[model samples]
Target: MLFAHDTEASLAAAAELVNTAHETPDGLRTPADVVAFVDRWSYTGRVAGDAEELAAVRAVRPRLERLWHADRDEVVELTNAMLRETRALPQLVRHDTWDYHLHAVPPEADLAVRILVETGMAMVDVVRLEELGRMRICAAEDCDDVLIDLSKNRSRRFCDNGCGNRTNVAAYRARKAGG
Candidate 1:
């Protein structure tokens, strides 16, 4: 794998959080949605399962999106700010089905803070490996989804939201019409 499983999972979770902000239905519009997301990601933590918690979680999208096109230094600055804001204290923890992985915040921490710390920690790997190019915005002209390019050949150019298929079909139709 291009990155460790934990890092990849964290990056994907981060991207999903950002995409939720721009999704057609506003995926995180309610507390129920937040619960669904937590379950979907299989996050083990103490969730308040309340409106305030949902809002806090939703607010981190833009901050995480900053990493999509950021340079190494910029990412480092942002990550450090996130870690500082969360007062991250890295601890190795094994809980649920997960093995030893870093958990900088307690399970009782705010969901948003936990999300930020986890994503920021994973981003440290992206920066350390000098593989920042793998973090990208969707190439589809009409989509602004964030993506992590974990492909073996670095050929990923679209989000997983069917943008690749849609774009290819559009291109084919245009060529057919022109011919």
Candidate 2:
């Protein structure tokens, strides 16, 4: 794997969270949407299941999104800022079916803070390994989604929202038309 399981998971979750804001209808429109996101991402913590909690999580999307397009130094600055802002204290912990992984904030911390800290922790590994290029914006001509290229060849140029397939199909059709 390009990164540890937890780091990859955190990066993927962060990307999905950011893409929600880019979705046509704004994927996170309600508390239920927040709940669904947490459940999907397998985040185990104190969930308030309220509007405030939903708003807080939604507010974090843009900040995390910036990391995808940041330069190496900018990523370091933003990640360090996130860790500091969240008062992150990294510790190894095991929960649920997950093996030992780093948890920088307590489960009871605000969900938004947890999201930021988790992403920051993951980015720490990315920065350490000098793998910042793996964080990328989708290559689809009309999409603005972000993705982490976990592929061994580092050829992942599209998000998981079917942009790759769409691009491929368009290319095939254009070739057939020209032929």
Best by TM-score: 2
Q: Which stretches of candidate 1 lie above 4 Å from their native place? A: none
Q: Write the per-residue lDDT of candidate 2 for residues 2-101, one digit (tens) a residue.
A: 8999999999999999999999899999999999989998997888889999899999999999898889999999999999989999999998999999
Task: State each model's CA lDDT, in order.
Answer: 0.90, 0.94
After superposition on all C-alphas, the RMSD of every candidate to the true structure, in Å, is 1.0, 0.9
Worst 10-residue lDDT window, candidate 1: 40-49
TM-score, candidate 1, is 0.96
Candidate with best lDDT: 2
What is the alpha-carbon lDDT of model 2 when measured against the actual structure? 0.94
Error of 2 at 165 (Å): 1.4
